[model samples]
Target: MQVLTAVPQVLSYVVALVDEVPEAKDVKAGWLAFAIFIGLILAVAFLGFSLVKQLRKAEAAEEAGLYDPSDKKPTPMPTVEPDRKDDTAQNGA
Candidate 1:
């Protein structure tokens, strides 16, 4: 009986305490954070889809022989001729 009587008093105190607390004022900040999170998710999804599309295009191009690594040979750099007058002076000609 005493416990039951004390329970109501505790409940009333809790209700009073809750009523005295102030409501949140930064609700807009919470909404902004959620918007930013959703935007980042959308951006990442778009980037992933684009990357896959580019990879598929590249694969198709490779299969069509548009990019043949084995047939590509590196061109040699051109050699520069020395000046004839400079060479003659060095040789004491």
Candidate 2:
């Protein structure tokens, strides 16, 4: 009857609407973003590990008396000779 015919028409219209939607064609960009994110994470992890190792090495060195403690008198800074003539005379007021 008319009701059965209308049901098929409605179903076809719904199917057409579903088919009209565009499929995802740029999946590679998503993968590239994921790869970059993972690389950043690994880089940060590597830096953290390096920092810990260096800190441990420094602690060990301190324990071995390789460096003097700051509680003691500081070492004098070495004096450096000027490499160039003073520029004050060149700048006329």
Candidate 3:
């Protein structure tokens, strides 16, 4: 029938239109993903450079006698306690 043929043609046109005009959400999502990937790569490179610089500084300090290994001593970490209110009136005990 002519109706069936017209339906297929309409569907094809719709498909073509949809393919031509992309949605804003899809474009935004792709840009966000690209930005995140680039940011992650930059952060990793910065961290690696920072680590290398710190290592070099430490080595230079050691060579200059800034740190003495023979006189090194271990120190204990301090502990902190949280303060709580004593509810003696509520318990009545």
Candidate 4:
């Protein structure tokens, strides 16, 4: 099949259609991008600080016996014991 035959022609046509393409040097992360980056950094820093503060508070609460910590798992429910008599009778039958 000549399925891929038009690929090269299409690529060449696309290249020809393009009048100009800026050099790599012309591309830049402008002030808007820099501002957004700075904003993200500040947001992360704020969240980190807030997280630390919350963790400290949680530690204090745990020390004061307000609530149990996640590391300490809750006591599991006791498993039900099967009737030994029924099991023995069934086996005998």
**CA displacement after TM-score superposition, residue 68 of candidate 4 (Å):** 4.1
At residue 17, candidate 4 shows an lDDT of 89
User: Across residues 7-73, which tens digit of lDDT does each residue of candidate 4 receive?
Assistant: 9998988988896777999988799999999999999999999999999998888889888567677
* lDDT at position 26, candidate 2: 38
Predicted candidate 3 versus true structure: per-residue lDDT over 1-93, tens digit per residue: 999879989999999988877677766557889999999999999999999999999989988899887866668789888886678966886
Off by over 4 Å in 2: 1-29, 70-93
Quality of model 2 by C-alpha lDDT? 0.86
- Candidate 1 worst ten-residue window by lDDT: 20-29
lDDT of 2 by residue, 49-83 (tens): 99999999988998888886775577899999878
lDDT, model 1, position 88:
72
Best by the TM-score measure = 4
Candidate 3 yields a Cα-based lDDT of 0.87
- Which segments of model 1 are wrong by more than 4 Å? 1-29, 71-93
TM-score of candidate 3 to 2 decimals: 0.45
Candidate 1 lDDT (Cα, 0 to 1)? 0.87
Provide the lDDT at 30 for model 3: 72
> Candidate 2: RMSD over Cα atoms?
17.8
Q: What C-alpha lDDT values do all the predictions have?
A: 0.87, 0.86, 0.87, 0.88
- Which candidate leads in lDDT? 4
